[model samples]
Target: MTSDVRDTAVKDAARHEARLLWAGNRGLFALLAAARHTGPIARVPKLGWVVTDPVLARRVLNDHATFTMDGEGGVGHLWTQLFGPEMAQFFGGARHAEVRTRARDLFTEDGARSLVERSQGPWYAELARRLAGGETIDVADATRVLAGRLVSDLLGLPTDRDDDAFRAVFAAGERLAGLAMGTTASTELDPEVVERAREIVAEITSGVDAAYRAAGAGTILGRCREMDLGLPLARGLATLLAIAGTETGASGTSRTVALLHDTGQQHALLRDPGLMENAVREGLRVSTPAPVIGRHVARDAEVEGQRLRAGERILLLTYLATTGVGPFDIRREYVPETRQLWFGGGRHLCLGAAVARLQITRMLETLHSTGRPYRVVSRRAARRVLVPTYASLRIETHD
Candidate 1:
């Protein structure tokens, strides 16, 4: 039994991550590979401090006064370049807290479950039916549409369009995120790239104008309007949410499905159905979809005996840090050091963590409801994108 679960056709977690990184962004792949041997906190020549330790990474994330998301290598800097300094306020200032606090109720455990059921329940039922009938399903494609659907539902976009519209929404978000691939040396975009980004953002947010005006208070667009955050900043936030919600969620969900099959843990999971939560957590941990997180040093500070000056950037190798514990195991317990570092740490922790988890959980549950394990028929990795994801993963379940 132990061997049956332990020795299976490996999906190769390391190889999968490496392939995704290499194919999606060679520059980032090279950086992470080179820095693999660095200390928990090592200062590189140009990139400054590179943290491979989850504890230190969380420390940096929690220390907003020292490290910020507003300037230089931080994600906020990218938004400010695209929108304006007003968007920067949402990243580093009190408005960050205000927005998160206001939207807090919408991301709680119950809230996440409710959101998933409201936005994606029907799709799951259909997927289960198909898989149970021994039909091959493209998990990756489904995940992309599912991610888009959830984001659309949250922003109160016109759900009137079919899944293709949301798939395009996901693609637009992908293109916008892809623009950041060349941002290793600098997060500042060239004029042409910025122009392209504007075009993409406009295309994706075409419905935002109407949603902002008519969306209810519970919706994100409506909340932005209620907060009196002008149109430009609201658009920036919407774009951020779209990309953040889609890329990571899709990657994590599909990868988790592949991981469980490759690890041959589906039978163990089948026997002890109570392990569903751990299976989801383990999947997310091993995948660590949003692998590297960047931050700009706002003020001078000494971390792990290394002095970091303001205006420098740090890259936290989140994928390596979290997965370093061991291979994918559905029975694995929560590790204190990692402590959900994949979703990120500190006040800026992903607002969609619950939503992402619920999505993956629902996918696993759908597969479990088939009353048998599934097999991966084939898989393809996504290329030239910001997030490492499966472009396609076809799986079939047996009775």
Candidate 2:
């Protein structure tokens, strides 16, 4: 086939595959099966271009020169806009490393412990109290609220109890998601949405900046300022931290609740409260919140016998990898020591993974300790389009 024909064919296949996977809940499982049996270098037209082998998954993520983080799709554009042009660490090699390193200190074990104590603990307590009040709560909504507050607090942002800031963020996310999934013509900010987004961003930025200004010399934000990272970089980092801190834990927690209620795993969890940690890990392994991650091939390389040229996109079907289709068997125990790629491989792996784990663990422990038997009311479950999430999971709790 001519190069044009080949490119067209690849694009067509990617669109089809993406639709199928998104349409069918079983796409995750299918991708894993393909990866295991096909030996990592499988063509997923649905996702466009490439899926890496297990061995190469590490190399693809780590090697910034040979593989780039910025892919051909509009998603990368949206990310750049949301995080700044220089934030394209996935595509830019050394630059990506530097940015990732600068923010690493915020997500360490000590950082996570402090975050949980100062932020997540109170949020969980509030959620527990609300649940105890006989309200039909959507766990996802609760998670979002808690995450937003925690993120805001961490960045020294003014997390007003007002709903406007939260609404603005949600609206921005919806517009961005639509743009990324090709559901919308453009993510060009609508006038109203743009205004709201700016308001929210300004509020967050000013709050964080003020905190840095007032903080003691040893504070995290204070230190970054002292190092002369500048206001823009500091603000960008704060925004990134807030969004990640809120979304990952919120989504994971809600999904875990949904899975347990759906699969009858809640009783199992209750029987062995000690199993909460394992169950959380299992849920993350099986249904990772951010299921798809991509990298760009920076240089000519051979993966699983397929010769990829520079600038080719390689999409990692992480949702599939988590399902244990090929080499993974979910029925067995998960050994974290051996299975390192769950959070991802190489330099760009999730910095906040430990924090996410702690959040999930605490949430699960609290729920299990309550000793409440809850049934998921399917009718009341709220569906989110962009992230493909459940807005609220209504649990009919029987004490």
Candidate 3:
């Protein structure tokens, strides 16, 4: 790796990421920065339990009986307030397992490939053509639109709308996620904040009501309906899909592009395309899209030799947990402890992990198709948003 592009790229990526933490939610940033020096599982003064060890983080996620997703500090708590108690209970009881079991097939490797092609193939083809023709395109913008298009298609939302509509959908999802930024201190959304989130959810789920009724058996909403999950729950499910699928995918893909280029590893990927898989994995590992995972203590439990009482909350500094392995290297082997901890562990593991990986694969393939390394003409980081990603990363392949 060249010292110039590689070194500055790392600095730029860090700057953007730090800004995201500092501007979006200082409380979260403080906890994450402090967790590095603290023990594996320590009680944060106002933030409850803060767990930076990958081992303990997974322990909390796996202990559904003790560390649950309901109550005041988990993200589900915010959703429950906006949607209702029925939704909150769903996160705790048997229903979550049931839904994950039923919906499992949709995210298999083959299924993810098909879903990505159906939702985003043509766009990638277009991008490939443009780069081949010497056009510098905004890869970051393309990922956001692509992310929007994929979520809508998966949920059987209206697709007659153009890229702008999907971009709007992506932006709305970001705004919806942004409303929760203040939740670092507490997952409880203020009544007025809840109202704003409701409006955003309505915008996000506007298509879900009809899609829930008419979507085919292949779509997620249809599966919910078949399972007797009513419109409200269906809306909740769709909104979750929208948030989970969009922001993280967009963030991970674009940042990966910048990371490879900034680190001057594009040449390595170009030489041995077999490393494509490693490249994608390294990107997501370094980026760790969700960055942090939160849980609410359901009962008195012991973790890392410390006891946590019911009603307490825990924060998993996953970025630190995963990044501790090493810096970004396409040659790096998988870390045993942090096996895909970014997508999370246990029942709540991200359903779209395969799709997210495939999306980045396609984008990298498209760039590689030109048979030459692409250079970053310019890039800008997104600010005050839930995910730390480039607002614009303009690039062009060598002609």
Candidate 4:
């Protein structure tokens, strides 16, 4: 592609991404827009401290002693309300580290690839077959089901049903995450909201009790039982896995597809298959599914010369932090400062990071296997959801 074409492609990708955010949540889009003008760290009126610089954002994530997830303004605060105070242990207490250590192998590269192949390989095969037959497939919808299938297999849930059954799994998780739509300025939830969330939690974990009892050691619930974490915490952890693994993974997958098409980078990947890894990284970086990360101040600390006191909150504008660098390019090298900041940093870094990457890599490879670049037929942005993504992104490969 010519330099002018590359520039135009870059702008087109940004436009589509902006629309997804706008359609998903206006408040989030506004915050991200404002962050562009703010300094590296600035305090907003009701939103607490906002950090847009990649370096500062990673610093807050790594500084667990000074910033916590269990207190006000953090995601854990929202979970504790729905799951009880014991849930706090999984956020900052020793239990957090213990759980990660115990479940470490399940999330490793080899383990992740095995899980992906076992749960989703067949679906990919079907998708590839359909594309090759000149069928237009909705990549976004496929991702939801794929995410549901992967999480179900990982949790040892019954995956013996149809695609709609797995779609229901994804839907339940989406409804649960939707409850947090009102939690941007405050992590605290209304009593009624908490009640509704618990109801949804029950729906998401309807099969967990049986799974925990009989699931093999390779599954997460099985590990929970081995750790003797009890039924309540097990339920909480299960719901967490459902939400954490599905929504972000689904969003990243679909958006990566759209990003490659919108930026005209799919042809580049088709030419140089070795750029597949870089393409995946650039996709996740450009379309950061979890655009904003919130943390509660644990104690007085200085970040970028700003003194933050306990009881306050900080919002890391990860979307702006990662995208501020540049547009998505398949050939772009790894960034030093933003080293996987999209997956987050420090001890709480996403345990399913490898799983997420492998999923995207598989998706790109499937599109490439057609031996012809695919064209997006149409796409609609998901609305009023925790993660901004496409509701339907239809595509058909050229003959």
Each prediction's whole-model lDDT (CA): 0.87, 0.58, 0.86, 0.91
What digit string (tens of lDDT, one per residue) describes model 1 on residues 92-132? 78888888888888889998888899889999999999987
lDDT of 2 at 203: 54
Q: What is the TM-score of each candidate against the true structure?
A: 0.97, 0.76, 0.96, 0.99
Candidate 3 residues 322-373, lDDT tens each? 8888778898877789889999999888988999999999999998898999
lDDT per residue for candidate 4 within 287-386, as digits (tens), equals 8888999999989988878888899999998999999888898888999988888898889899999999999999888877789999999989999988
lDDT, candidate 2, 1-399, per-residue tens: 466754554354334334433542344435544565654566555454445344456666677567655545323434556556655544354644665566676678887777776766776776667667665655666666667666665565555666556545544444333334431223334455545545555655656768767644434466567666667666666655655566556667766666665555577677767676677777676556666666656678887678877755677656555554322122347654325455776666777788788877777765654578676664232333334445556664666
Best by TM-score: 4
Which of candidates 2 and 4 reaches a greater TM-score?
4
The whole-model C-alpha lDDT of candidate 1 against the native structure comes to 0.87
Q: Which ten residues in a row have the lowest lDDT in candidate 4?
A: 361-370
Inter-residue clash pairs, candidate 1:
none
lDDT of 3 at 210: 87
TM-score (C-alpha, index-matched) for candidate 1: 0.97
Report how far residue 31 has shifted in candidate 3, in Å. Answer: 2.6
Cand. 4 Cα-lDDT: 0.91
What's the alpha carbon RMSD for model 2?
A: 9.2
